[model samples]
Target: MHIEDLAVPSVNMVRWGAPKQWLFVTPEQENVRAFEEKCRETFPWRKQARRPQRAATHCSQFVRHANVLVTTEALLDWGIDFSETICREGELVVTLPGTYHQVVNMGENLAEAVNVMWGNCGQVQSTYVCCSRDGCGHTGGVSQEDLTPEVASQ
Candidate 1:
């Protein structure tokens, strides 16, 4: 991942690639829309139930055609500063609501991430802009009521 990475609110654990670099934008509600738009420019989040987490990998054709090199410029244009951080192995990066972050693996490596919203994590008006044409998206508030408390990967 070069730049222009779009992600939802979550925590990322570095299982490998100790010296991984990350790009982040301190999410301001007014700026989230623009930030998401910039990310969409590079990787559009579409497809059945697919989130931004899958765009960079699952959408091969889009990835090939998208010019993500302009990510830095896009971030700046949106009044969003892309902050870089390097995490060592076994480090966990927690993202607060309304913040946007991206990870760049130094090389072939493994990493695990989980997306969760704490019930007491305060209210962020946690909004996600979905590009789905299936009508499950909105540009504003996604409250706790919108999420489930458990997961079944099977």
Candidate 2:
């Protein structure tokens, strides 16, 4: 079939709606060791609204539906981590439906950004389960999953 032969419906057509969204800002995008150092950073971390990173380590969270992450400044990376970026006014990262990622504030302003999720119209499902002892507790989050290899092989 031709590329245009495939028929996928648009989210606006259905009354389903978009994914959840929120803005985030942090002081330093700390590594595993400097994790504690970030506590002293001057970003806003509301005690009640604090949601731990949803990955094996402190990485960015993925949105269930489609999302547009607009950063106020440039971003830094961790060794070889990869993400989708489109730079216009600032930098807009159009993340894969559900891909695991992390970010560092290469820019100056703490780290400001807005995320919009497209809920049901999104692609895969992601699961971040925390299985730690100390009876501290375990939790998991479901988002979309990555579809790179599956699409690339074709």
Best by lDDT: 1
The local lDDT score (0 to 100) that residue 94 gets in candidate 2 is 38
TM-score of each: 0.53, 0.26
What is candidate 2's lDDT per residue for 1-154, written digit by digit as tens? 0000011112111112222232232222343223222222322242213244222123222121112243333223222222332223333443333323334333333223433334442332233222222111232331122332344235
lDDT of 1 by residue, 1-154 (tens): 2212123357777787546778767666566556555555645533323443334333322322243443666667767656778777788777765455556677766777666645644332333223232233432464334443432111
lDDT per model vs. reference? 0.50, 0.26
Q: Each candidate's root-mean-square deviation in Å?
A: 8.2, 14.0
Q: Candidate 2, residue 4: CA error in Å?
A: 30
TM-score, cand. 2: 0.26
Collision pairs in model 2: 18-119, 19-117, 19-118, 19-119, 98-144, 126-143
